[model samples]
Target chain A: MLISSAQGAVRAADTLITANWLDYLLIAIYFAFVLGIGFMARRQVSDSIDFFLSGRSLPAWVTGLAFISANLGAVEIMGMSATGAQMGLPTVHYFWVGAIPAMLFLGVVMMPFYYGSKVRSVPEFMLRRFGPGAHLVNSLSFALAQLLIAGVNLYLLASIVHALLGWPMWTALIVAAVIVLSYITLGGLSAAIYNEVLQFFVIVASLLPLTLIGLHRVGGYGGLKDKITAAAANNDKITPAKDQLESWPGLPLSGFDSPLLSVIGIVFGLGFVLSFGYWTTNFVEVQRAMASNSISAARKTPIIGAFPKMFVPFIVILPGMVAAVLVNEIVQLKASGGEAAIPGGASGDVKYNDALLLLMRDVLPNGLLGLAIAGLLAAFMAGMAANISAFNTVFSYDLWQTYVQKDKPDHYYLGIGRLATFAATVVAIFTATIAGKFGNIMDYLQTLFGFFNAPLFATFILGMFWKRMTATAGWMGLVAGTLSAIAVWSAGEFGKAFELSGQGLAFVAASTAFVVDIVVSVVVSLMTAPKPEGSLKGLVYSETPKEDLIDPHEASLPFFQRTVPLALIALAMVLVLNVIF
Target chain B: MSHTPERYDAEDARDDVREDVADAGTDTGSGRHTAGAFDIRNIIGALLSIYGLILTLASFVGDQSLDKTGGVRANLWTGLALLAAGLAFMAWAKAKPIVVPDHIPHDDDRPAGH
Candidate 1:
């Protein structure tokens, strides 16, 4: 009997996810709602603006949920949980220390410039501040980045479907792509945003139960802590229990031995450069804010998102921690230094990425298991749709409309946007194959962000505030910054120049890019002539009047509704959370 | 600023057409107060309600799997919570419907001059 029970454990790994009919029904219902929202939203798209920006008419709550949901893609869910399983408590820094402050800064300081200027996309904002050179560079790079990232999301989504239903990989990929493509093509940004809002709730619903059930199984947080401590003592390969339990310094997460250097890397590199660069400027996130009905709503969007954003670690990261302690497969894989096969994992290898799936298989029953599967689908689709929608907008407005075909009618551009969406979806299917080639897609994703966003953020912060920054400086700064980042990344990737590896390398690369861009912009501005003060009126912060930057009506609202007060409250809450954890 | 009046007149015309459609009963007017023709809340509420119903029914009829979750009836509880949340969203939508204005001007409708 004992021998047979042991043999059963070995067999259980091969068939990890076994969903009954009830689970499939839940997933079918979810897909129906997703596609239905798309068809409904299609009716509202009368022009390019509606197709691209939802006609800037959505309220704060909808756009706010969409803002965070667009970001809560497959990477955010699976990747963060994987990180939680690997690095433990230090992963919380990605949210509290890294995201919240920058998000608040975007709301209080940056949203006024972005929304007040009324740019269709982030690249368009670059065009207004810089010129054709910078705009072209920004547009092409952004479009390429979206396609690559969309591929990553698409690949993960298809892999989940393949794992869940035992479908062939090719069939899974095509079926997943068509679902997202159909909705995005039908509804445009409105469809994407509505689905995103729905996705957010679905994600929370699915993960929250997993976390609770896992915690309950492990004898709560206290029991998990004891198990982690015991595991750390037994396994010398993993991070120390103390480092795993605490959020400070994050030595293991940073890949640095020295505590001081690790803190600086976490605070400046990840928190300031990468975090601010991403939350403030990424068009995928910024487009949600731009779809708001009013300037005040736009400003409140990110700030509202920040509220839910801070607490997400509980559902996402906690489950990972629980899995690390509770799941026999993960424990064995971790001890084996991830050399073992993860049984039913899509990758065929025991990777940290399989932590969430393993945990769900161990804990959830059939009915709830189906809900969790649907949640993951919603996350990946929301992520891919965001990339595709943002890609189509930038392609139509920033690239094709601006350069390829000028002076087009509104409906003509709208048609181009839909075509671009189709082209991007098809391109993304191919890109997903490219993404599959990489061993760790997260490292690749971080490297891509470092290449595109870091330098762009540097140029934006400089040009927005410094009235004397020239158009020549704008493009030059971006080029030099990107090259410097690439150089730093390659040095770390291939050579032994930097002591860092993994995410630490990406952070260093981003910081180098930011500093290089600033230096280049300053030097170029000093040499070349600046744009005239008249042309810089609304683009430059100093030249734009205070009233024009904000909604005067927002002052009459209650403190909770006001942007500044709400941001401050959020800021205070995050700081308290930092102290407690 | 220059395109403000023209944009408003265009929106007013669209509003008139929408009102006529609403009177004809072809349009359900789910978003009569909202910007679009459909309320996102209703979609969310409807989806959650369906999922909640399935889970709730399954909790009674399907395998309990109480041993897997350490003796907890997770489906029953989570289904009830979802049902409550779904009903709350529906109620909130009914209580405070968003008012869509006739026109909301764009920041700049024209192409950026090179």
Candidate 2:
């Protein structure tokens, strides 16, 4: 075998992740401690509120960390690493442009309605503002979406744990589900939040070492970029021109090797529409903000989250960049030996999804390796817990309680909430089983995210700010918006089924839905009778007074005490990274 | 729209425990802050302590490896680190006990059980 002159040669046999007693001890301790937390949290389950919102007593810091950690799923760790390796610095767009601005908007603009309006779920806001029809549509879709997400998390966890533990895939999944569900059922949202905080810390601890070690081995950040450029030059297939490697965030929609979606897609679709829709309206993120006890705490949740979020591309995407370079070096070494000068040359095929796994096997030692693997395992569980916890609440409150039974005792709902956790877990297990049949699970999940969140932001914006918007108009716009997204996504799936180079026009459809929802909402609103501002207190901009929305505590503190300063800092960091890279 | 306390959960307030923390900010810490709200720090410490003790003990008995683990007994190191964290959490919780004001005002109409 040709030894490539990069950092060091990685033999095939060395990739095996063998766990000694120390490693097993760490893993065992992790599981036991997790189960213990579940048991401990059990006593605190006083009512349905405690079961769902952790009694809404979490301070800003807890909710804030949980908010982002809830999202740092298997997808973000694995898929985003693949993105970083494939796209280079531009994948940072996902954190910077796609998430941060929208997160800020959610904190500053939407918290009044979400937190102050006394809504239990996102759909509750729909019910209060737009009435039953819209509530039914939003809540049902959200519930289903969450279940599918839980399954995706399950599949990712099972697959990775299967690799690390060398256990049957089913065994790993069942153990994870049992562990996560136990705590969730016992402690409820509080359990999920508490665990999410743990997962957040663990993920950071696990990934930080990998980045530092990899950077040290490959030389520092300066050398890292230079190595990538040199590799790109040698492997001409990465891009047509060396100019592509000149700066960070190369050409948009340049495809494969190029980082970033097209400028139009990033600005119009992601930055303007999709980001706003998902961050502002998605119940998953909004739930964390809503759980804070005080108004200021709730509003500050996402803002605090945004700070850590800015650094995530470094944690997630940088490793991918390193992996991509390593893959190229291996491929280049093989090609020099007169093999097929083709796409699948030298190393057969390097699975980008396995980039972090490769990095782990290459760099991390067995004990820390096991801990790192555990951290990864925790990430998936945190994601799974977030989904199942959210799903159970929405399912119980929105569907089961609303449509099936009504006005039972508080204890009755609390029991149902616990029961709902099991139900959600079962559905997720089944969903993960089915998801195994899919060709690419990531694409399937992305389609679901885009299908729901893309158009919903328009309805949310109008509903929150526009008093003249009728309840009928709100529901109608939402329905029309949802249908348009579906139509586009379905068409793409249809095209792909026939082997036509036509997989869904994600950005095109999302951007179009943003416009379509706005037009449909305005036209429908004018046609229907307007709801008066007086009847919309706490739910609409005009009636939800600015004073009620303002953080009373913020005034007593300095400007830096507020979230805006942190948001500004986050933005400044993004700008600096963009320039340097 | 006539207000009957908004019936917070339309399904059956009995099953009303879903969604993110947003519309669910009913915990003003007004109602009984005690029944096991050990600042969440307590649990973190407990967890760290449990893991630390187990791993620390295993470090002596477990198969030693320099080739596999970059010459570091990571379990032993990480375990000790976690132990300290757990103990610190216990100390912090003991040092300061927080009490919620009796009348925490908010516009969130507290549903039954909230």
Candidate 3:
């Protein structure tokens, strides 16, 4: 038995080790193609706004597509797929419940405020509403946030690339960084977004076909059903744990111990938090929306984006559950190489990360495998481009230009922007090593992300709606929010380390900060005098859309409001399947 | 007809010639074209696509039942749903033409005859 086990391991190692010059050639070809896109985009680069904002030239659809593509990096794909492998179907509740609608609302509601106000950066809004002091604080915090974020993205992409191809870890990291930096430096936002558009296609084409092929190999849907049903017969992890069937973080739930509560919590808590935060305030997301050619175009983009967002689980997550069904079949047969040899969480949950990768290796034919690798690279590239670009924009425009050089030439600032992009890439690499040390870095990464963003989201939101929110109030609220989230995270207060699939604690902290910032900023702004009239009016409101001064009517949004309900229906369908199986 | 910078074919032809000659030598303007590198339409389509794909993938994770006789029906249904949604989007954008704005207004204003 020992000899046989060793032989199996040896064969697997050999298969991985034998990635040849062909593979390297393929990788090089991909890099060359991506760099070619960058070189093509160079002629478009101009002054600051064009570099940072794509010169605000994007129409609604382009903004929406680029926005979604920017965030769908290798990290999110691997991270979310890993979650599905561990947690099951309810995991998607994050995108369906929280993120989709928030993005839609951002487009239809908040975008006009930003676009109409003509603010160059998210921080610029805070500065105009409050003062230069608020701008300084927001800008500094955002720059730090992007710096940390750049590191996390690099780590996620590197891990996947190293695991699949036997590329040295740093090789993957540097290659990934270089690909993104080349385009961003040359073409700026335009190049980044354009490449992101291409990456988006390659990724979906790769993942979708592989998912279908896996389903076929597993004896189609019925075979998948039989396998999952058999597993559920033996294991409880296939269903919600008794304790987890409880409550959402903020919204009411049936008391804990109710069998349905865990499912509901899974649907809302895990699903809502992850999706909402990404959609609402993340710069990569907002930058896409802000690039719309017109306010009306911006508003329509998210609604269009959301219509398709309702279907995430069917493609990315279900494949894992299907893999779960085949776990025993694959293990017993001990099929030659690839996913068939490993089972879920058998070695550790890290194998769960290997689930999708393993599936592609075992099932896909050679040419198709090349396509899959290309798709994975696309995911990595799209995300890397977004992160580096966001870091560059914030550093050059928000940090260096604002702080380091008060009055510089347009060309000089552009040069600084390029330099900042390179420096940010280096800093991100160092932080990635720190990221590797954490056992489950998702929650910590998220909470830290929230620490920077929670305060900022609150200040941005308040600055738009409320006239009186002073700069001091915005700054104080921001500081208060970050401090509160950190205090909550450090005390082991949320119970399990990976509670609610790793996002519940961070969500609670961020939501708390958002609320507190609003209450404090509003009260203080009222107590203090309003900003001196027209001085700040141009920063916050737009007159052409008469709806700007007041809260836009929350009338019956038959299509808009139903997104959550539609999500719930989809969730119900999944739950019904789990029950039957 | 309304005298809003109206130009007859002969006059417009002469004017075009004059403008071509007028703009021949300026380094800043020479050989420079305004066509942008990026197409917001494609980027937005791609972004919406990825998010849509994620959501679609999520919906399939839970348990569902299909006719035993209809082999691969469920997977097919799910794939069809995703492909339909994804492709429909790409197709719709292709059908609807994009209209680029003629110019972006600049914030800094210089004296009229610099």
Candidate 4:
């Protein structure tokens, strides 16, 4: 195939890969490894909590690894890379400012209530306090969120395979989905958690080496710095610049005035909304927290989870920036009538995905490439496994028995959970196949997931704070929030009534739903005969503690004393970096 | 009136049973309290339920530019207060000291036998 005309930057990558066998071997090996792990863990899978929630036996560290691993899907690696390719360093704020704080708060604050309440799923908690309606809304919202999220994860996995091995996108997606589903189906959450831990390590090993080498290849660290500095020197960098510039400090467009309100809106809306939503509502990761053996263990899990998240940006994002500098230079070379070889269209979505591929093919040499490929594969497996396991668990517990066979046997329910896992995987495969056709599938999937997330998280949070939030009001608020998000998206996509904003819209919709739900639920709860706060003990843990509950400071006193100071120290480091850089 | 040794032994047995059930690997006894000791799903869920609580407060604070604008000290303080409260709720799952319900219907009473 003829290289694209504007193939200035990818010329180096274009010439290097004459050997197809190596790519196939790499992918096959990657597949075998992940499936093998799943098979091995399958033995440990029990029918009840062990299979569903890892027997709640995982200590802090393993739980921590599984937690981080589960979060590491193709969405983050590719999405953040695309962001980094455009945005630069300020995007790191997504972790330091947004995720870390949330995780820390979740660890120190949220763990006790959940641990004490002894609920299985977050929605199950809602049902005990509110009613069946609350549980239904929560479970449905979660299922929807996981549904789209699974497709997106598969799509990213497929893109990498397609780019590396020249497999058809759909072919790659099917293969990826089947491999992931086979093991995930076999092992359930136990295998998923165990495999996730392994995948986390593999991804780190794969990316870190490539990142270091890539930096070195681009004229060492010093040379690399000069290249990006030159790129930034171009004032025209604004339009085609990476997606994250709005958050970069001292970058001409940091917040509100940036070309799009997306960044500012995310900062204002999503920083809080998504953090709380994912932390509280998303059961996939929180299930790991729930599976912790002790209250103290659960409390420490989020904190431990936060530390890796702090570093992940550097591992994934920095290399993309390096690749951007390299790719842009190639474009400049081609502009001069040089035989510049680019693999795909430069500056488009395809090239954005290909940029990382190009970097890997070009920079990673022998055994190292195998390792790096393994990392990508690890990311692929871990991400997919997390989604599949969570979906299966929710489907089995929340949907299958709850709706289909309310009085099924334990063995029967376990069988159903396994069946649900298979069904969920099938749905994902079909969805990813359809989603694959869309060029900017990653971006679209995230926004759509955000739409589903905005309302449910908002209602659940409000129900806790406001005593008056009745079940009827929660249902109303959930409907309102989801509809509000849909209305925003619909107006932007279908009606063209208003310009479609990005992350900001999700935030606004989520916020509006939360506010409205509280208002309506409170009014209705109070106006209609109020239910006496009966059996609301373990259900709602507002500001006051039950008598036996130890003060958190006293309960995990030793850990808290050290962690608080340590967190402050890290905060200081970030502040210092801001000042210096 | 309730000082029987058998009663104390029975209470101990029940505690052991509860702990055993908590770790009941796949044993979903009819009355099994899946809600474990460290279950923060609700608290986290609740805080998360109120989406953007902190962000909303942060916006108002930033809008007033209280640090920069010199708004009424109370507005500044209130913003600070809301921020702290929001952070506290989001951070400490046990921030809301939930009193374990006084009346947990016995699993024996429930139709499902644990």
For DockQ, the strongest prediction is 1
Instruction: Give me the displacement of residue A315 in model 4, in angstroms.
Output: 0.9
List iRMS (one decimal) for every candidate.
Answer: 5.5, 8.0, 13.7, 20.3
**Clashes by residue pair, model 1:** none
**lDDT ranking, high to low:** 1, 2, 4, 3
Residue A534 error, candidate 2, Å = 2.0
Identify the runs in model 1 with alpha carbons over 4 angstroms from their true place.
A1-15, B1-37, B99-114
Tell me the TM-score of model 1: 0.92
**Per DockQ, what order, best first?**
1, 2, 3, 4
- Cα lDDT of model 2 by residue, A511-534, tens digit: 767777889989999999887647
Model 4 ranges with Cα > 4 A deviation: A1-33, A220-222, A232-264, A328-349, A494-504, A543-557, A560-581, B1-114
lDDT of 1 at A442: 66
lDDT of each: 0.85, 0.69, 0.57, 0.58
Please give, for every candidate in the order listed, the TM-score of chain B alone compared with the true chain B.
Answer: 0.58, 0.54, 0.31, 0.27
Each model's chain A TM-score: 0.97, 0.89, 0.82, 0.86
Candidate 3 regions off by >4 Å? A1-29, A236-277, A327-349, A493-502, A538-581, B1-114
Better of 1 and 2 by lDDT: 1
Cα lDDT of model 3 by residue, A1-581, tens digit: 89966754543353331233433444455566567667655655666666787766565555666777786774456656655555454455555555565676566556666666666667766655777777787777777767676777777677666665545557768877776777788878877877776666656666776677777777777676565455445444343322112113212121234346544544443344334445665667778766655455456556556554555556676656555544443323222212333332212233455556666655554333554676677776677678778778767776776678877778887899899888888887887677666544445556776677766766776676666667678777777777776766654454444333345556666666666767777777777776666676545543133565222422343543333343344446444544533
**Between candidates 2 and 3, the TM-score winner:** 2
Q: Candidate 1's residue-wise lDDT over A83-184, tens digit each?
A: 898879999998997789988998899999988887889999999899899999999999999999999999888878766766656777898899998998
